[model samples]
Target: MLLALLALAAWRAWVWWEAREPADHAPAADVRIEALNDRISALRGDLRAQAQRIQQADATNRVLRDELLGMGQRAALIEDSIARWSDPDRHGAQALRLDEAELLLAMGQQRLLIAGDLDGARRAYTLAGGVLSGVDDPAFLSLRQVLVQERAALDELGDDPRVRALARLQAFTSELDRPTDAVPVASAPADASWWRRAFSTVFDIQPRHRSLAVRPADRGDAMAGLQLELTLARAAAERRDVEAWRTALTRADAWLQRLWAPSPELQGRRDALAALAALPLSPELATLGSTLEQLRQLRSVRQEP
Candidate 1:
């Protein structure tokens, strides 16, 4: 019974000590709780800052990705351009240049041969040469040399014979249209005798073999014939018919002899007509179509399977 009572008293004392220890540590517990709350608040602030940093990094990654996409597109475009320029078939800008050059060459030949336009032909050839010069291919280098030779040949030609002939004909026509001065006939003196004057008026003698003066009515017919012959000559010259041009000019000379009294001016005009008839309508060109033909040949060879 004594031992039981002592054990009870000890248990009571332990319970009381435990209760007093909690009261003594209450202020320290409050301080530790406040410190933990402050730490938690600071941790929350750090988490928010880290989240903002992550968002900023994501935005920067998006911007970098967009820039990379634009760079990739530009790179693709550059590659396509390189592929187009390096094509071997010549179906790109080079082919277009060649086609233009060929067209200009043909135009130049036609201008020279058909139209007798030397200046126009030269201009076309010059433009064609300039176009051909842009070609970087070594195979066409000889063509450019041939073109230069042709241009030099044109330069050597000086002026077109047809143009000179036409100018001479126009001058002849202008002279023909001018009024001829009346030649003063030999007459007796002003104080001559009445009988001499009456005889001179009654019997006027002119040489038969000399050029018979055309009557006013016949003058119109002669003028028309002369004009017709001149027109024929012009047409023949335009047609590049050497034989016909000479024949028409010969007929024109015959009409001129019939229409006009022989004078220095008339003789000079006849000489000009003869000179015009002798001029060549088409000047000989050895290397006329050489460049065009060579270009065509080169193109054909390239196009072959």
Candidate 2:
């Protein structure tokens, strides 16, 4: 404001001075006005150039600011990655344990759900427990508890009466290889009169027909019969039929007795059969339902960050 006012005042003073002077000063005043106009024009051009330079500088500064911001963001990302990599909890023995536990859990699930093998499932569950024992995270602790429960449930399922009976019947099929017991035969009186024996031989009519005498059980037939009985027992156990299972087992034992002589091994097999027959027709699976699926879901959840 002050500069513009001063310039206006100077211009007015010059005009007044020029008007008051003689005509002799007219040419000089005109020349001076021309010089002043040229100076103002040059000053205006300089001002325009400065303005353009200022604008360019501002644009460059904006670009530099954006680049710096991007670099800062990249640096932050690198630092975060480094921190994560260097974290002790995410590597080494704990990491390996977590991986092994997950693998064992998966194996246990496959054995239980797909193969229906309780022993295999238990083995896998036990191994998982061992792997997870060193991990102290709350997630891992919960996982361990789940493993224990599932393993126990599997054991209970294995001990189920129906399952036990089926196993026993299957095992009984192996007993067919034993030799058949010798069949007892009654002999004719040796003290009988010689005339009686001679008369019987001459008439071809004897007190006992040789061909009609009892014979030892046929090995093939006994084995086949035993197999059939076992099949029946297994089916009955599957069907949860108590009386049918008992009858099948009894028939199987009778076949075994015919094919195997009385001995401790035979007696033990019979005792096992009798024990299975005494079990209930229906047995509870006991906390086994969905145990594997729950464990799998837990494992998946814990694996996430």
Candidate 3:
């Protein structure tokens, strides 16, 4: 009986000890281990999050590096292109350089947009506007500057029309500079006023030769000539280049800009005709009146483009 009681007491003590020690407990042990495993799993999740952030940052850095590389190459090309552009006197170099500038600017903007740097892209395009606005190229400079100004204005306002407009303008510039022929424009010599005859003869007789870029349709020069004449005539009385300007004005497309002053020869002829008319019965006066009446039928006229 005593032995059995001792054994029972020992058994109870062992069970109590087993309940207090975590590894010795069955269901309790499993619960503690599971809690520890949950803590370790949370830690692993945090570590993975940090690693993902680092990888994303690295990817972003690589993208920025590549963009900078492209920008560097483009800058070098622009420098090379500008050597001829700045000359101002080269035949088509200005247009070519400005065209290159436009393309580079677009490429830069594209890079910015793709990188999600909208503000940076806007600034780059605005810089392009300023750079291209003052280009001294005669043919397309004014038109291009206008387009740039409009583009900048739209971009500044955050309007979405700017990109589409820019694309169209670039295409226009490409088409405008293409090569064509230079052909003669024939106007009647007899219809010319005495002074018109002197100037018109120059056009009527320009070797009828076409140079590399001169085209039969290059009315651009004719239009430019007219613009030049109007510009000159505005300051004619105050200009030192009046003679050169005046000589150029008389032969300009003749239809676009009118001569401001009557020809001296025409004035003299009119005076002579008046004197002849004053002679009571001079046959010369009758002949002169009759000639003026007939010549009025052949006044110069313009053909629509």
Candidate 4:
């Protein structure tokens, strides 16, 4: 306002001076020149203020843009995490990760107990329990619950406790969640020799003493893996997803066939596989003979055990 008023006053003074009849033309020219300079000066000052305002606005806009970009990135990450949690393929992977985490917790607590770190062991076991909360895969659930118990036991036992408290494995759990699809390893239960009867009771399996007649040397081997594959093959049978069924069947058969096929050099595993394969398929066994044959042919063309 002051600059505008100054400009107006200067213009009026110049005009009045011009309107006054001066004898010399030089006086009139000098008055006109001074008025032109004042107008230029005012224009320059307005342009400088406008430039500063523009720069400030640009800086503000840049900050806003950076903030918006950060928000977008955060949203994208959340979407990816949601997708992973809900994906069918990821169900198995998530379960696997949780299983690993539980095992780690157990091992950590066991160490703490050994080191005489009772409180640390207690916290570790608690965290381990939390990791498997709400998880319902039967085999894994059983094992996870076992781990929870193990954690508590570790807390109960003080440093270098009697008989290494875990020696009996009453609280031991296996990594397997469900009975495997393929074949069961005859002997290896999740608990070492320490916790046999207790584990069977907890998992609702027949007593080890009784199963001994049927169990093989590698009972707990990849029995779960094999059984799972067989189940997958059976599931595909409904849709007659022949190729997929064949893939699964072939995988199961090949695993068994590899055990005790013709080559005596690798006799033991081949023998086990043959025995397992010879057993009659359960009532839920699929009737996809052609699919099974296709798998056999594929395996045959590849290599024998």
TM-score of each: 0.56, 0.38, 0.24, 0.29
- Best candidate per TM-score, number? 1
Tens-digit lDDT track of model 4 for 48-100: 99999999999999999999999999999888788767764346754565645
Q: Which RMSD values do the candidates have, in order?
A: 17.2, 18.5, 30.5, 28.0
Model 2: pairs clashing at backbone N, Cα or C within 3 Å: none
Q: In candidate 4, how many clashes are counted?
A: 20
Off by over 4 Å in 2: 1-22, 103-127, 136-139, 151-305
lDDT of 1 by residue, 1-305 (tens): 99999999999999999999999999999999999999999999999999999999999999999999999999998987777567664677779999999999999999898887889989999999999989998988999999999999998987788777777877777777854343213355568788778786455455688564457656667777888988898888778888998999999888777666565656777998898888888866888989899999999898654
Best by lDDT: 1
Q: What is residue 149's positional error in candidate 4, in angstroms?
A: 22
Residues 69-108, candidate 3, lDDT per residue (tens digit)?
Answer: 9999999889867764554434355445555556645654
Please tell me which model should have the higher TM-score, number 3 or number 4: 4
Per-residue lDDT of model 2, residues 4-110, tens digit only: 99999999999988878868788998999999999999999999999999999999999999999999999998987887677565566776677677778778766
Native-to-model Cα distance after best TM-score fit, residue 225 in candidate 1, in Å: 2.1
Instruction: Estimate the overall C-alpha local distance difference test score of candidate 4.
Output: 0.51
For TM-score, candidate 1 versus 3, the one ahead is 1
TM value for model 4: 0.29
